[model samples]
Target: MNILILANQDLASNLALNLLLPSLQRHTLRVFLSSRVGKPGALPELKRLRFFEQSLCNEMLFPHLPEPGQRDAQYLSFSQFTPLLTSPVEIVNTINSDESLSRVSALKPDLILSIRYGGILKDPLLAIPKQGVINLHSGLLPDYRGVMATFWAMLNGEREIGTTCHFIEDDSIDTGGVISACRLTVHSERSYLWHVLQLYTGGCELLLDAVERIAYGEKPVARPQSTKGGYFSFPQAEDFTAFSQKGLKLVDEEEMLEFFKHYYY
Candidate 1:
């Protein structure tokens, strides 16, 4: 099947692409990375994009992986078998205007996979694929829908955090058909960054499952999300601080060191 991936350049989206792209050999895949690059002095841009990067970077989720080797390994493991992707992967610094949605349409993809593309996909654009578009969200749909669902789940002290692969409807947000979901328990001692990376890794598997099921002409499942349990956006600074203070249950430093060594080595 021919697949087109719509994604951004941030860690989450980039990691998703890194894993997903190499797996494209199984299906004909084309990737278009929506660039998050900005002008040096762009006022609102720095506040919105750079600030989030800095804040999340400092939070220490995956351990300061400044070294390319460490970062590559973390991304590759999540990719599983996708690293075999031999198809063309194009990085577009901006998909807002100059992006030829037409060129993407020309690919005539059997399916489109959207993972945090960071922009609204209009009908004229989403209509290109022969099969419908789908998204793998960080939160389990019908409950937590929107940006930072993983973080929001952590803040809420939810026992489980997971991924939702859903069909794309005409709506702007998460109002869509359910495809499939995968969830895992959040360890009290784990940092929010750790929790999110786990979710990110798990999401790749769930997404692959959803793709295979749909490719086989099967109806995965579609359930309406409860209006009562609605959307939540990113948390504010004060809220984050409060959650940080209470969310993590302390583990002995030696135990933590041993655990890190076991995983890192």
Candidate 2:
């Protein structure tokens, strides 16, 4: 099968790719990584969120990833893995634009997979693939929808967090029918970043399973979302305060470093 993957260019998304892409070697794959560039006049909170996210990626994640023309057996870096891909990855912000649509149409993808992709897929783009687009959302749907879902789940004092694999039936965010969902225990001692990173392991497995099922000429079952789950945007300052009050953190450097040691290296 020819698979086109739309994913975010971020630490967590990259980690997901690391887990997923290798297994997809059997299929023809094209990847487009969406940038996380902030919009003009973005809120300070959004800017701060982006800053911390980029800092973690720059300071810790990227350094461990392989450099151009370099491959280290000790660790699998984004640079190292990408070069192994049959097609060169495209980085684009204008995913739904005319040019992008043309480019994607030319590929003639049998299936489209989205993981933390920033852009919304319009009807034209959604119509391009034969099997249609499936997204691996970082949160379970109907209950948690939209950005920073794990944060919202934690802030709401949920003991478990989840990831959902669902069909992208339209332009709405995370409202698609569910193919599968996986849950993980929320460890109070772990950083929010840690939990987010951990989700991809199970998430990617679900995605891979979906792909395999599709390849075998089986349509993966999808259940429509029955309830209207609350949608969450980036947290406000007061929300962060509440998170802290609950003894949770956005990032824990030491814990992340230790995790990286075993997981990445």
Candidate 3:
């Protein structure tokens, strides 16, 4: 299977590629990474990813950090990173113009997997693949929809936080057909990174499962999502304080412990 991946350079997206790269060794897999320039936040996962683009100042890769020992580059926009980073097997760069689309079209991809690419897919782009495009969203669909679902899940004090792997459809957000879903506990004190990591892992597993099923010639089922539940971005600072005092009722200790170990240590 020829796989084409679209993602930004951040820990979550990079870690996802780390997992995805090994699994996709059996087939011809090419990755296209896009930079999210002008976006202010933690450095995107794309920075850590190595590709074949002209060396754009290694300093740009390691932006100023608030604290010593931490690399603090702002996040890369989907448009910025798509055309800069490319490798022999993976084309990493920012997609600045329509010409990039032609390059993608020429790949003749069997599957196009998107994680944190942060862009919407349109017709001809979606039609390029035989199996169509798939996204491993960080949030569960219907129950937790919209941007930063895992962060919202943590802020909301939800007992379960997970990932949703689904087929891309006509909607702008996560209103697509569910291929498979997985959930895990969210302990109290688990930071944004913790829940997102869980979501990443679960989403990856579900995606691999979907891929294998597709490889075996099974048409994966797609389920319509319920419209009753939906969510948005992470909680504000006040919201976090308020949740600590009133809104958030619970947290998971084991998960929090793991989160601290991985993130803090």
- Number of the top-ranking candidate, with lDDT as the measure: 2
lDDT of 1 at 215: 81
Off-target runs (Cα >4 Å) in candidate 2 are 37-52, 55-75, 262-264
State which candidate, 1 or 3, has the greater TM-score: 1
Name the lDDT of candidate 2.
Answer: 0.82
TM-score of 3: 0.71
lDDT of each: 0.64, 0.82, 0.63
The candidate with the higher TM-score, 2 or 3, is: 2
Quote the lDDT for 85 in model 3. 29
Best TM-score among the predictions, by candidate number = 2
Off by over 4 Å in 3: 37-97, 234-265
Model 1: per-residue Cα lDDT over 1-265, one tens digit each: 8888877645566567655665556787766666543232443533543443433432353445444345434343222223344354566544435357667666678888988776666676667777788888888887888776777787788899998888787656876887778897988787554565567677887778778887898756777666655687655666656665885522233443443342244
Query: TM-score of each candidate?
Result: 0.73, 0.90, 0.71
Q: Give the TM-score of candidate 1.
A: 0.73
Error of 2 at 38 (Å): 6.9
The runs of at least 3 residues in candidate 1 whose Cα sits more than 4 Å from the true structure, single-residue gaps closed, are 36-88, 93-99, 247-265
Could you tell me how far off, in angstroms, the CA of residue 130 lies in candidate 1 after the best superposition?
1.7
Query: What is candidate 2's lDDT per residue for 182-235, written digit by digit as tens?
Result: 999999998888899899999999999999999999999999997678888777
| Structure candidate 2, residue pairs in collision | 65-77, 66-77
